[model samples]
Target: MANLYKLDILSPQGNIFSGNVKQATIPTTSGLITILAGHTSLITMVSKGDIEIMLEDNSVKSFTVIDGFLEVSDNVVSIISDFAMKSDDINDEVIEKAKKYAAEQKQKNDNVPSEIAEKNLQKAIMALKVLEHNKLKRKKRVKY
Candidate 1:
């Protein structure tokens, strides 16, 4: 049997996941990094990307992390994120509506804060990307 490491993933709202995982792939500012058991203790800032975790059952779970930090020590990895959610948590319809609303607001309200608009746009885009990735994976599985 493969060794397992503890992975605790947390969002600003609360803890999302905590379990024994075989591996975890996180997106750092530089690039994607994969961690396994016996990985060195370190800390790094995570980018806006997917965090893929390989579970003990050989299933892969993905979470979208907007901006966050990760700490690894003693075969335990902890992730604290500004925002984090499983790919399944994002609804395509909801994201589409939010994108449309942001576009309308950007056009109608000149007083809207640029930062707010940017944040909304980024979130909408990220949600769409996650949804699309899941859709493609489902399609591929169906074809096989």
Candidate 2:
């Protein structure tokens, strides 16, 4: 049997997910970090990215995460983020609209700070990436 780890993903609003997962990967400020059963303890800041969870049954769950910290200890992983969403909960049309809105924001950001505009663009791009990655995962599952 695979070792199971307790995972709690929380955002400011509330808990996003809490359960046992075989493994998880999250993006940190430095880079991507992958955690497995019995992983050593550590905490690090997170950036805008995806959190991939491998369920015990070999299925996968994913979340789009932004701005948080990841902690792992004694086979337990906790993610505290400012924003997060389950991949399944996100719709394609919503993401497309967000992309278009981001583009518009960029064009109309003449008075806005460059950093803010860049951040908006980055967030929109991350959303698009999450949708694409989840779609591919779902397709792979359907194939198998």
Model 2 Cα shift for residue 123 (angstroms): 1.9
lDDT of 1 at 29: 91
Off by over 4 Å in 1: 100-112
Alpha-carbon error at 103 in model 1, in Å?
Answer: 4.1
Error of 2 at 25 (Å): 1.5
As a whole number from 0 to 100, the lDDT of residue 18 in candidate 2 is: 97
TM-score of model number 1: 0.88
Per-residue lDDT for 1-144 in model 1, tens only?
458899999886888999999999999998999999999999999999999999988899999988889999998899999678888888877698869988988999799999889877988999999899999999999999
What's the TM-score of every candidate structure?
0.88, 0.76
- Please estimate how well model 2 matches the true structure, expressed as its whole-model Cα lDDT: 0.84
Per-structure clash totals for the candidates = 0, 0
- Model 1 lDDT, full chain set: 0.90
Q: What is the lDDT of residue 72 in candidate 2?
A: 88
